[model samples]
Target: MSALDFIPELGHRVRESVPRLGAATRFLVLGLGRPFHRHFSIQQWLRQVYGFGVLSLALMVVAAFFTGMVLGFQGYYALVRFGATSALGTLVALSLLRELGPVLTALLFAGRAGSALTAEIATMKATEQLSAMEMMAVDPLAWVVAPRLWAAVFTVPILCVIFDLVGIFGGYLIAVPVLGVDSGTFWSQMQSNVSFRGDILNGLFKALCFGLVVAWIAAWQGYSAQPTAEGVGNATTRSVVAASLAVLGLDFILTALLFS
Candidate 1:
């Protein structure tokens, strides 16, 4: 067959996949329904939230500390050269509270927790456990997906706090003791120049949204995975990619809406 003859066949195959695509979209919306009530299983939600939080803390702490230190050194030197050293606190607070803390935490969580969730659920599906749950009249969405989503909602903002604290300490170590910045002057400048009500609230809000996106993508992909180990691996990879992209995209939209 000539190449021209294959075009119609390709289009036919694409048309055949439309229903599956529609079904996927429907599933996503269904999961969002009654999100609050479905997510209210206190014990399960607590375990999921805290479990991911504790597991990922070490990496986040190390990353935040170094991030703060580098920004302090780099920002301080550049500002001092321009005779604008007083603005260092403003820059640090704005950068960390608005961008670095939430974005970095979400990326890290997607790589760590997102991948784990996808693999875990996908494996269960492959082993027939998910099917058994369905046969027993237990709603897998409630038993599996809701708790994770709720947990992420709780966990991610808490993680952001850890990120901000470590990052501030990193800046402290570089600016105060090392660079001879007066500790009191540095902290007071941070406090005086930063708008806590706006910056802190916005940062936490972004973190919460990021957590929901990450958890939802992970759970959705895993639960809908095909019955093969390869499918599980693909779901895990896609979960990370999709979750990270959603976090960044949502961050931009949110920043514009909130600040602009």
Candidate 2:
């Protein structure tokens, strides 16, 4: 294609995307508000909680375990060189609670839960299920999208907490029993160095932001996808990629604002 031809196509794509972005924002605002005013079903919310939170528990635990082991191993060696091996517990706990715990949990959520959500919604659209709901006077956005969004909002922080806990245990396993670090010192030093507000709560805050971003991108992409199998697949892919990028970018911004 000629350069001039590409210009028109690029402009067209930008114009198309702008309105969709606005619509998605509106959808999120309305979804967030509606539950407060209307009678949202507790059953639906619980179902989403199970789907988004419970279903992903095993994977989160596994990831946290391996991550903690690696941190323990590396931190032990690093601190040993400086004769500060006693600080290993503090290093592992703080590192997991403050940074890796939230970031990696979010990336995993995006890859696993976020992609599934996009695919599910897009497939529904592809099959005309969304249209059917609309024709029957049911607000699909409120019924389908809102619950998932709220679920994700709640679930991610819970998952992050779990990740931090499990990761710390894994670190302790490696540091204490395997590496011969003093068990009492491990727990004690962690308690002394890691502040609840500065590390743990801030990590949860990051998880909350990541949850919203991941859910929003997944739902919006699915809702706006073209009604076709290929479109649904593409939307799922985009949702994962976009949510991952959003998590990393937001992590940097939040760290600067909250810590710096």
Candidate 3:
């Protein structure tokens, strides 16, 4: 076939796929709608919340601590040259609150929790457990998706806080030990320079949105996976890619909206 012939054929398939995308989007919205309702079961909610929060806490802490230290070391000398060493706190606060805290935590959560959720659901689908649930008249949306979605929404911001704490401590260690910054002065600068409302709230907001995106993407992908091992593998991979990209895209949009 000529190249032009192939192009027309491709356009036809692209148009055909649009409806499937729309269907998926609709299903996603439905899933999100019921996640916050009164019937969303306290027991199930507690389980997923604990899983999302407590399970991920240690990892977030370590990651943030190291991230903070690196930011401090990297920014310190640059600020010193401009006689703006006092700007370190503002720099750390802004960078962590705006970028590193939410982004890194989301990426980690996508890799860890997102993958786990995808795999778990994919495995269940493969084993026909999902089918069994349907046969029993149990709404998988209510029993499976709602709790996890809400849990992720609530847990992500908490994880972001953990990330911020670790990152700041890392900065403190590097600044105090290596740069010889007076501990009291460094903390005082941070307190005076960093506005809690702007920095903390913005970061937490980003984290919450990221959590929702990651969980929904992973769940939607996994739940809709074809009934084959290879399909499950593909779903898992796609879940991570989609969640990460969405997190980045949403962050940019949120930044513009919040800051503008």
Candidate 4:
């Protein structure tokens, strides 16, 4: 546990990760590029959309609702201290539409669907299915990887929008009747403050970026997984951890760029 003891381990990790990151970058380039060379399959993309988006809808709704309700309680109390309870809707709406909605949706999606994507691909690799596709003159990158990548890139923003709407409603339910704030004041303040070009669009853009990060990381982790059951589990875990960290890091950079 000595401070000096950590340096060699950290350096070892950095050395190992440099090559892996390079390999992943190559995989990403092929994943993004190969689809353009092949005939597109809308059906394949739709199937993946269902898996990544529709299947995860209930989780999104429940998480978003509770998150909004929590925000309502916190925002109301924090604002009321300054006699600014009337800004509750503004607080909740701006928070959701700008930051919470996209970021939380991405984290949840990375945990749920990104892990699933990595697990599925890793299992297929473990079972030699990707190799079998190659033997049949089919490119696995095009047939397997592209659809899921595009589907995730498309669905996450839609999910974020849904999260925002549901979260706002949950906050309203708490702020209005439950907390006795006027409904009109709540919504009107939100409407007056929230803007299409600023709040909503920025969130959707963040969602889009997160989708790409989740899909790319998950796909690369699975594609590069060791062909073993234990490797599949490890790859899935890595996908979630990597995607979540990437989303958070990107959020800070993007927020600064968009707002500053």
Candidate 5:
């Protein structure tokens, strides 16, 4: 295409994107605010918590354990070269708590929970269940969106904490018993370097932001989906992809802000 033709096309695309972004933003604001409305039900949020947190518990714990074990093995080998294997505890703990724990958990949450959310909502839309709710004088956004969003926003940080704890245990098991490092030194180094506020709180904050991003993106994609089988599948895929990228991108920004 000619340069002039490309310029107008780009401008048209940008203009189209404005409304879509505005809709998503409005959706987020409304969904968040809906819980404060008088008719809000705590049970709905609880059910979503079970769906987003309890159902994903095993997956999160298992992944965290293996990730920590892998970090332990690699950290030992790398640190052994410099005769600094004693510091393995600090390395593994900081890496997991500050970076791996929250980031990996977020990615997994995006792939698993986020995709499920999108598919469920999109399916409801495709089957006209959302429209049916409207016909019944229900606000679908309040019933369908708020609870899921808040549950996700709340649960992921808890999952992140679980991931950190399980991962640290896994690393300790490998570092102290399997790798033949002194148990005392491992605990000492980690305890000395890792502070609760700097490491744990910061990581939890990151997880919170990531959860919001994941749930919001998933819900928006599903709500905006084309209400067909193919569209639902596409929305699910897009939710995961978009949420994952947003988590990574946000992680970098958070890291720079919190640590640097």
Candidate 6:
């Protein structure tokens, strides 16, 4: 194609995408707002929590455990070079709490819960379930989207905490018995060096932000998906890819904002 032809095509694509983006944003805003003004079903929220949070726990734990062990193995060797092997605990704890815990947990959540959410909603759309609800005068955003979004927002931080704890133990297991580091020194160094506000709270904040991004992307993609089988599959794939990128990109921005 000629340059002039490409320019208009690009502009047309941008114009088409802009409205879709706006519609999704409006859906999210409305979804968040409706629960406050109407009857918010606790059961529905709980179900979503179980789906988004509880179902993904095992994967998160395994990821966290191996991550910690790898950190312990790497950090021990690195610190040993400088005669600072005693700092292994602080290193592992700080790495997990500050970065790996939230980042990896969100990535796992995106792949598991987030993709499932996109697929479920897209399938509902494909099957005309959402249309039937609309015919029955039910708002799909309030009935379907809000609970999942809020559930993710609440659950992700808790998962991140679990990940951090499991990771610490994993580090201890390797650092103490396997590597011959003193248990007392590991715990003591971590306790002394890692601050509650600086490490733990900041990491939780990152988790919350990541959760919002992942859930929002998943819900929006599903809600806006084309009502076809292929479209549903595409939406699910996009949700995972988009959520992962957003988690990593936002992590950098959050780190700059929180640490700077």
The most accurate candidate by TM-score is 5
Highest lDDT model number: 5
lDDT of each: 0.84, 0.92, 0.86, 0.92, 0.94, 0.93
Off-target runs (Cα >4 Å) in candidate 2 are 1-16, 37-39
Q: Write the per-residue lDDT of candidate 6 for residues 1-260, one digit (tens) a residue.
A: 58579889999999999998898888878877767745467688899999888888898889999999999999999999999999999999999999999999999999999999999999999999999988988778778888888999999999999999999999999999999999999999999999999989999999999998999999999988999999999999999999999999999999999877
Question: What local lDDT does model 4 show for residue 145?
Answer: 89
Model 5, 1-260: lDDT tens per residue?
Answer: 58579889999999999999999999999999999765467999999999899999999999999999999999999999999999999999999999999998899998988999999999999999999988988888889999999999999999999999999999999999999999999999999999999999999999999999999999999999999999999999999999999999999999999988
TM-score (all chains, Cα) for each model: 0.87, 0.93, 0.91, 0.94, 0.97, 0.95
**Per-residue lDDT over 1-260 for candidate 4, one digit per residue giving the tens place of the 0 to 100 score:** 68799899999999999998898888878877766756447788899999999999999999999999999999999998898989999999999988999999999999999999999999999999999988988888888888898899899999999999999999999999899998999989999999998999999999999999999999999999999989998999999999999999999999999867
**Which pairs clash (backbone N, Cα, C closer than 3 Å) in model 1?**
none
Instruction: Measure candidate 6: CA RMSD.
Output: 1.6
Runs in model 6 lying further than 4 Å from the true structure:
1-10, 37-39
Q: Give the clashing residue pairs of candidate 6, or none.
A: none
Residue 168 CA displacement from its true place in model 3, Å: 1.0
lDDT of 5 at 93: 95
Off by over 4 Å in 4: 1-15
The alpha-carbon RMSD values of the candidates against the true structure, listed in the order shown, are 3.3, 2.3, 2.2, 1.9, 1.2, 1.6
Candidate ranking under TM-score, highest first, comes to 5, 6, 4, 2, 3, 1
**Alpha-carbon lDDT of model 4:** 0.92
Residue-level lDDT of model 1, residues 1-260, one tens digit each, is 68698899889988987976687666656655535554346687677876789889998999999999998899899988887766676677678888999999999999999899989889989999888988987766767767787788789999998898889888878887788777777777888877876888889899999998898888878988886989999999999999999999999999998767
Off by over 4 Å in 5: 1-6
Better of 5 and 6 by lDDT: 5
